[model samples]
Target: MSCSIKPVYGAQHPPLQVMPKGKEERSKTSNKRDAFQDFENNTSDAWDDGDDDLLVMANIQMSLRDVRSTAQAVMENHSKQLSAQNQQTSSVKDELRKLSWSGIPKPVRATAWKILSGYLPASLDRREPTLQRKRHEYFGFIEQYYDTRHQEIHQDTFRQQHLGLGTILKDIPRMTSLAHLFQQKVVQEIFERILYIWAIRHPASGYVQGINDLVTPFFVVFLSEFIDNDVESENFDLCQLPQETLNIIEADSFWCTSRLLDGIQDNYTFAQPGIQMKVNALKELIKRIDVPLYKHLEEHCVEFLQFSFRWMNNILMREIPLRCTIRLWDTYQAEQNGFADFHLYVCAAFLVRFTQDVLREQDFQGILMFLQNLPTHHWQNEEIGELLAEAYKLKFMFADAPNHLSKKK
Candidate 1:
């Protein structure tokens, strides 16, 4: 399924912009005050040592207070919007989609993700019963299929299970090695069971290497419901949690991962025709969105698959930090067929995000190396928000114009 690039006719959009490092921190009142003080000190000679200077400093401080007040109000408004939507008895999906397109507030993220992923019903009345039934059904799967992994009478099944567990075992520790929660033995065992159960159930794709990474976002988000601290960096004793609580987390992670994979399963199937097509789509998208970078790759003989295979395969779980991936998925779940459709635009937006860097690289190896080892380790929710904003803009421009990415004659 090769994708042919068609010439784009309209004026190219402006290059994607990276949000400046420490943009969020710099926006804080303390930092703004410090910056103002520095400015005052640097130009003190220009001001009179009198009442005028005092008045000028007071006005500057007042402006800083106003900035802080405005920022606080915006945050409060977003929080109110999320709370109102989640508390509704009927479907608030359209509102959720709009609010979630930017980002979901952490407190309601778990319930919001469940509803967005189709794991929980939109009606508040049905949600509790549906959760109970789904959780019980998932554990029943554990009782039935999980125990059969060791039954040697079914040699083929045993072999498949063995291989799946082997791969999952190899990948789980490496998935988020630095995350404190994942480093815990209890958490590792939970991940192992979730991956193994999911693999055995979905025989069609049967435990791809990158699938292990997909479970972490769901696991951490659900676990956050039980813990008080940050699940990403905070070290906590999973043993403190009761067995039933752990079971609930494990089951929820499994089913939510299932819902996510259901939309993009072809990305892991034989030959991964879905990812191949997506990678090609991403290339065509970039060709339209940023012509110079596309041409630079072409001139260097750099193929899209060389770098973007991991992007499509893991939905960029490998590229960005775990926290960033979680934030990115908030938008993914909110969009219709987000993982499969909007993700293409995200990849396009992400690639063009490095337009200047890509254009600066003169050779094939340089461009590939730069893209693979991108400096995203320090990226936070603010950066992820900017990325999603650009992705949405790209989706708006080209998603409806299928012929913009259609096969060339």
Candidate 2:
């Protein structure tokens, strides 16, 4: 079988999975080869005439148009959300919350994330000044921690020993830079500065290996908010942006990331109590839900921590595509106490999504490898919606109430 490559799509519309032209050509070639080998004398009907190839391409384009049409609901929701009556209305908030669970429209995702993260000030009067103050403060960090050239040496390995960090991560200093346009060197500098400053201020929970991964979602979301063009269709020329605008994006991302980490800080502190607890919770939940699969894992002596450390650390950002991660985060931010609790359920759903393939692998190495590289590049909005729906259903079935994770508690 040949590789199924996903098409390069625009961000103005929702992701619609399409095959790349190169892959299509390869498939056509493969079909011709099969036709020749299978029945050389009477293979005209069996041979690919390219008619099927045309239909496949046509179907993919139509699917894209459908996704675009579906996103119009978010546009309408944004307009409704602007109504003064909808500002504090429970009905309005409830509707917004419900819509976000499935997906937030790209037209209003930035505003929705701010509202969900509690980063946006509720009082209309305080919004601008609050933003200005935060933006200025962010630059203050740049001036201070980032004064020297970008360096990767440990600040004090003894301090890390004193903190007694239980887990050792390779290349802990550099974090995930989600956007591809930024130069690798530039991205490294940006994260090093921000993370170093954050670590110094927090003291209790300084820069950790996975913390870098946490920053990407916030950065990409906020960058989308600031940049006029879709990042998918065009490259982000960081130098072109006004210094002030760039600073604001950086500040917004930093604060939002800090806010998220605030709730889950226990996970990163010494020994990672949150992760240990989560691993146990996940094992228990899986045992209750899928006994045979749990048994299979147990038989292989495959510890959940071996596979799940990165999952908890990165919030599954590494597992799925960036576009889908945005959609997943929308529901997560919408849920009450989402990051700390609801995320556990999302993980469960994600694991079960590939249960059949996972179960097929009996050995520890096979199962481990299969999970680390889940086939997600070709997944589109439909797949994401279904995943969230399943995740929500799992949350509903297991959680104590409408907005809680029962097993985690």
Candidate 3:
């Protein structure tokens, strides 16, 4: 008697699935293999055909055109999230009340306490220029000398700690360069503990090195605010601030950084596939819309991917001065999700603005580096902002052309 068996995708076979035990089983397997081979051949033919490229390109262009309208939507979203606008003055007072100035180191505590109480002097001498200057000097020194070197060393340490595991992170600091007594082991432990709090809070994006640098200011800012919280309103008695400050920073760290990362995170993971997608999409857009410049760059080999990764990942923060960085961050936070569109326009603007010298360059690497070192002055300039606005306007009007299409037909 003939017999056969056939494989099934899931549970509970139908009555038709029952087959003879021997010859039927062999025929069933052969049929299944033939079916899979047919599927593979058909899929290969569809991809090899170039008919799908134009439709795909059109959809990409169309979405880019919608960027301006989307950006406005993003701005409106953030405007609605500002919950404390009416109580800005009282919020400042409440933040000050929670801090315990004495618990921090002598100098930071002293200066931080003054800022907390609203006793900051209006005028400034060299010896006491202003509270702002001191904070700058402190953070600046740490950034230039210590943070720079610490990355070199701690990167090795981090690899040793997390390597071999799939979850191992290769990029982390060997040592954190904290300022003043905050650099001491115990104090730094507290800082690390707070960072762990932040990491756990942001499970989606765990701790990263630059994150420490970003959060340091928030820690200092909140520490000062919380000083008043430790003291009673009537007698001003000293006590610990609420445990919630840690939680608040944890939660807000996620929210604020998430907003910041929206435009930038693509650079890190997209280094190859993702970055290539964006750069290629931009190229397709330029080819269709701005042919002359596209030909010029293609001749020089200055693909958008080469320069944009750094711009988007760092949000132009590391490349620019701290004052400029903070101001940009303020605007970015204010705009919320629209920052992604704004960031893309800024990238396109930089390319277009530098088109003259860039086109003149002969080598790919030279033009690439030129874009990388593209003037921070340009980024800070008002004209650059106008260019960004113009780019956004264009994108909003025409972005949807390349967004909807089927690659397979």
C-alpha lDDT values of all predictions: 0.82, 0.71, 0.46
Per-residue lDDT value at 336 in model 2: 80
lDDT of 2 by residue, 1-409 (tens): 8998675433332334347999767756775445334332343443466545643453354577777876887777778877754566546456678778878887788777776777776456767888888778887877765563234333453265342222222243333333354444444456555666677666666667778777777777777776675455126666766766667777888888888888999988888899988877887778777778788889988888988877888888778877777788888888887888888887887888888898899788999998888888887778878877777777778786532424545
Candidate 1: what lDDT? 0.82
TM-score of each prediction = 0.75, 0.69, 0.42
Q: Cα RMSD for candidate 1?
A: 29.1
TM-score result, candidate 2: 0.69
- What lDDT score is found at residue 392 in candidate 3? 58
How many pairs collide in each candidate, listed in order? 0, 0, 43
User: Which sections of candidate 2 miss by over 4 Å?
Assistant: 1-95, 144-179, 182-185, 230-234, 401-409
State each model's C-alpha RMSD to the native: 29.1, 29.2, 24.3
Residue range 1-409, candidate 1, lDDT tens digits:
9997654322232223245668745555355555555555556655556635654565464578888998999999999987886677334777788788778888999999998888998987888999999999988888887766676643476475445566777788888645677778888889888887887777777778888888989988898898886453346678989999999999999999999999999998878899999988988888887888888999999999999999998889889988888899988988899999999988888888888988888988899999998988899988888898898888888888889987667
Best by lDDT: 1
lDDT score at residue 73, model 2, on the 0-100 scale:
79
Residue-level lDDT of model 3, residues 297-371, one tens digit each, is 778767666666555544554455433443343333323243455455445655676678777777888777777
Q: C-alpha displacement of 297 in model 2, angstroms?
A: 0.7
How does residue 120 of candidate 3 score in lDDT? 40
